[model samples]
Target: MILEAVMLQVKEGMESKYEEAFREASKIISSMNGYISHELQRCMEVKGKYLLLVQWETLEDHTVGFRNSNEYQEWKKQLHHFYDPFPIVEHFSRVML
Candidate 1:
């Protein structure tokens, strides 16, 4: 499985709104192909910081299948504007050590 991680910095005074939008946006992501699971976490130290973790069957499932789909546009519409500088997404696999 591939793990997609994103560090999100929400715009000031928009944390609650972001969370509500994310709850709706989650439906869009969870319905995509190769989607396994996802979670959104809030940071204790930072007021506007959040961590988004998603599990996919493969990298393309996210980078291509999801990102390139029409649903992605909806996803962006639902949650993208809440971001300040925009989030950077990265993928990972198990170390298997």
Candidate 2:
């Protein structure tokens, strides 16, 4: 599986709205092809900071499949506005060792 990780820093005072929007946006991501699972975690020490972890069957599932779909536009509409400077997304794979 491929793991997608993102560090999100929301705009000040928009945390609650962002979370609510994320809840709605979750459906979009969850319905994508090859999506395994995902979780969003808030940082205890930093307000408006969140960690997003998503598991996919393959990296292309997220990078190409999802990102290029119509649903991605909806996802972006719901949650993209909340980011302060935009989040950086990275992917990883499990090591056999």
Candidate 3:
């Protein structure tokens, strides 16, 4: 399994808008090939920070497959502007239980 972690900081007073954008884009993401699941987590201490965790069958599913698909373009159009600057994405593979 591959884990894609995206940490984002939204503009003040735009949390609901960002959330709405995510909801709109989630349909495309969830339908992408090799997609497993996705979750959005809100930080308790931070006011505008969110964690987007996506699970895929392999790294290529996210790095290549999703990037090459038309769905990605739509997803990008819907969700790209929600961040202040941009979100940083990282990937990981489980090494232990």
Candidate 4:
């Protein structure tokens, strides 16, 4: 499986709204091809920092199949406003784990 990790640094007092927006945006990603699963984890030490993890069957499925679709635009609109300085998303494959 391929894992897409997105790190979000939400501004203070905007956590709730960010989370709500993500909740809606996730549905869009989930409906796309190669989507395996999705999970969001919050940082215990950093109040507004969060990790958004998405599992996919292949890299092309996410980078080409899903992102190329019209759905990505809607997802971006719904969730982009929450970022203070935008998140950097990276992908990885399970080499050992």
Candidate 1 clashes between residue pairs 3 or more apart in a chain or in different chains: none
Q: Candidate 3 on 25-63: residue-level lDDT in tens?
A: 999999999999999999999999999999999999999
Q: Measured by TM-score, how close is model 4 to the native structure?
A: 0.93
lDDT of 1 by residue, 1-97 (tens): 9999999999999999999999989999999999999999999999999999999999999999999999999999999999988889999999995
Least lDDT summed over 10 consecutive residues: which range in candidate 4? 76-85
Q: Estimate each model's TM-score.
A: 0.97, 0.97, 0.95, 0.93
Pairs of residues at least 3 apart in sequence or in different chains that clash in candidate 2: none
The Cα local distance difference test for each model comes to 0.96, 0.96, 0.93, 0.90
Arranged by TM-score with the best first, the candidates are 1, 2, 3, 4
All candidates: CA RMSD (Å): 0.9, 1.1, 0.8, 1.0
The segments of candidate 4 whose C-alpha lies over 4 angstroms from its true place after superposition are none
Leading candidate by TM-score: 1
C-alpha lDDT of residue 82 in model 2: 93
Clashes (candidate 2): 0
Where does the lowest 10-residue lDDT sum fall in candidate 3?
Answer: 79-88
Could you tell me the TM-score of candidate 2? 0.97
In terms of lDDT, model 2 sits at 0.96
User: Poorest 10 consecutive residues of model 1 by lDDT?
Assistant: 88-97
lDDT digits (tens) for residues 1-97 of candidate 2:
9999999999999999989999989999999999999999999999999999999999999999999999999999999999988999999999985
Please provide, for model 4 over 1-97, each residue's C-alpha lDDT reduced to its tens digit, 9 standing for 90 to 100.
8999998999989999888888888889989988999999999999999998999999999999988889998988887887888889899988894
